[model samples]
Target: MFGIEINNIQTDKLFDVDRALENLPFLLEGVPYTLLLAVTGMLIGLVLGFFLALARGSERRWLRWPARFYISFMRGTPILVYLFVLYFGLPIAGIKLTATAAAVIGFGTNSAAYIAEINRASLNSVSSGQWESARALGFTYWQTIRRIITPQSTRIAIPPLGNVFLDLLKATSLAAMISVPEILNKAQIAAGRTVDSMTMYITAALIYWPLTMLFSALQDYLEKRYNRYL
Candidate 1:
């Protein structure tokens, strides 16, 4: 009886896995949405992050203080909480967004805080002498940043920025919580129909793993190409 029961369990597990594999196409259909979320969010974050970094680095107290507060608030809060606020809390104040839009905004805003710090640190890592030299060469501060500092800082920032991209990619799974129909959402729907949650979720994990590996490879290529100057 014990041997028979064990064999039955093994058969059930195999059946579940087979069902998951069969439903892979349905799950894969969500990949574009997930990719869209990550890419759009990262782009928005990059733009906002640049300005935030500038504000944080500004000499003016008014500009610096608000930027500092925004960064601190974003970094200190949990991302899911931020999402909840965007999706749920905003509705009460007469603002409404579709699930996809909210997810993009939430992820972008949260990512901006980290990216701002990354940019600021990378800019600072360029030697003080570089800034002094640019000034002595008759370049204004903004011109110096635009012409000299930014080019060098971008190379230094690439690796960490890649890390942020991967992180943002993974975080898009949270969009499922708001009914954005991302991979996890589709997987959950399949699991509900098939009653094989384990296999479905494992499939989701497998999908995410390869996507992450792809990003990592791209990161490596960029790092090598950029650092060739060294």
Candidate 2:
């Protein structure tokens, strides 16, 4: 050993509960922006993901290929890198987006790729027999999907969709990189002021834990409710 002594090392305080508690108000103020980013991004993802799922399922080579390529590219890229590119790259291409706009777009676009796969899996889980049955009943292909496949697939999709929602919520923290002022950004500011990095980050975790727990509880309830008949 190189003369380094563990016994003589000093560790910073891990928790200053009172200081963390005092910073709660300032930190919580960012919660609305965080929630807004998550909610709005999810809504965008849901709409685009549904179409992407359908396109991937389409018989046409053109539609399916584009959807496949989109999913592949988005899945291959990290969300933070995607955000940085969209935020910084677009301006150079003669398009500009505000930090909030870029955050939502980046999160939604990346989320759509995963959501598309989730929806596609749910759609495929429905029995093929039902598609045949609908055809025998003289339903058009679109009609069969709309009336028979979509409803059941929606129930199947709810649980996984909830996980995606929670992930998007956590991902909102990355928005701070673009100056969106979400929760982690506030915590960083507090840490800088107090010079207590450990305590401030622990406070952020405490804040996120309950929110995630509540989302998990809601996801369970919906999954059970949707599957009650089975």
Candidate 3:
């Protein structure tokens, strides 16, 4: 028999697993609000984006120009700047919303600009004859868009829209600045009080990591489902 001596090496509590576990509940408690903001904002943006996309694709100069300008302005600005303007600046003009509400609106509006472009490109990918075919079948323009164009465009648009939702979810962390008390805010409070920055952040990352993975899986599933229709 060969004999060997082994000695144990002790590690510091700098990355305390117990501390992370203790802080996780508090940090994760705010995840519901974070999901709410992301889902509601993305839904609002999706609806607004579709209308804007159609308007942008219109032949009329009046309609098309305004849509172009809106896309240009929203895409040109940073989301954090948009949040500041909506949450703080609008109060000066006698219009005000709660920090959470304002964050949702700001994020949604900014997202719509990007969503609009993606939707428009998807819409364009379909042949113009598809529209003419729908019209010849006695379908109204709205009906045609709702029933035909939308279904096809959805296949093209889902991937990018999923990207937008992921972007929105991450951006909700910015709401911490306005005291919306989302995931990051809760984690910050935990870090401040515990003086355990590394532990608290690791806990928050663990909390959010699952949510990101869930969305990613859902996106892949949806893309596959839609791709079959294509």
**lDDT, residue 69, model 2:** 99
Q: Against the hidden true structure, what lDDT does model 3 obtain? A: 0.89
lDDT of 3 by residue, 117-219 (tens): 9999999998999999999999998999999998998888989889888888988999888888899999999999999887787788777788988999999
Could you arrange the candidates by TM-score from highest to lowest?
2, 1, 3
Query: What are the per-residue Cα lDDT tens digits for candidate 1 across 1-230?
Result: 55533433565574466787799999998899999999999999999998899899999999999999999999999898888899999999999999999999999889999999999999989999999999899999889989999989999999999999999999899999898998999999998998888889889988999999998999999999989988
- Cα lDDT for residue 8, model 3? 75
TM-scores of the models, in the order given: 0.92, 0.93, 0.91
Worst 10 residues of 1 by lDDT: 1-10
Q: Which segments of candidate 3 are over 4 A away from where they belong?
A: 1-14
Off-target runs (Cα >4 Å) in candidate 2 are: 1-12
Error of 2 at 23 (Å): 0.9
The local distance difference test score of model 2 is 0.91
lDDT of 1: 0.92
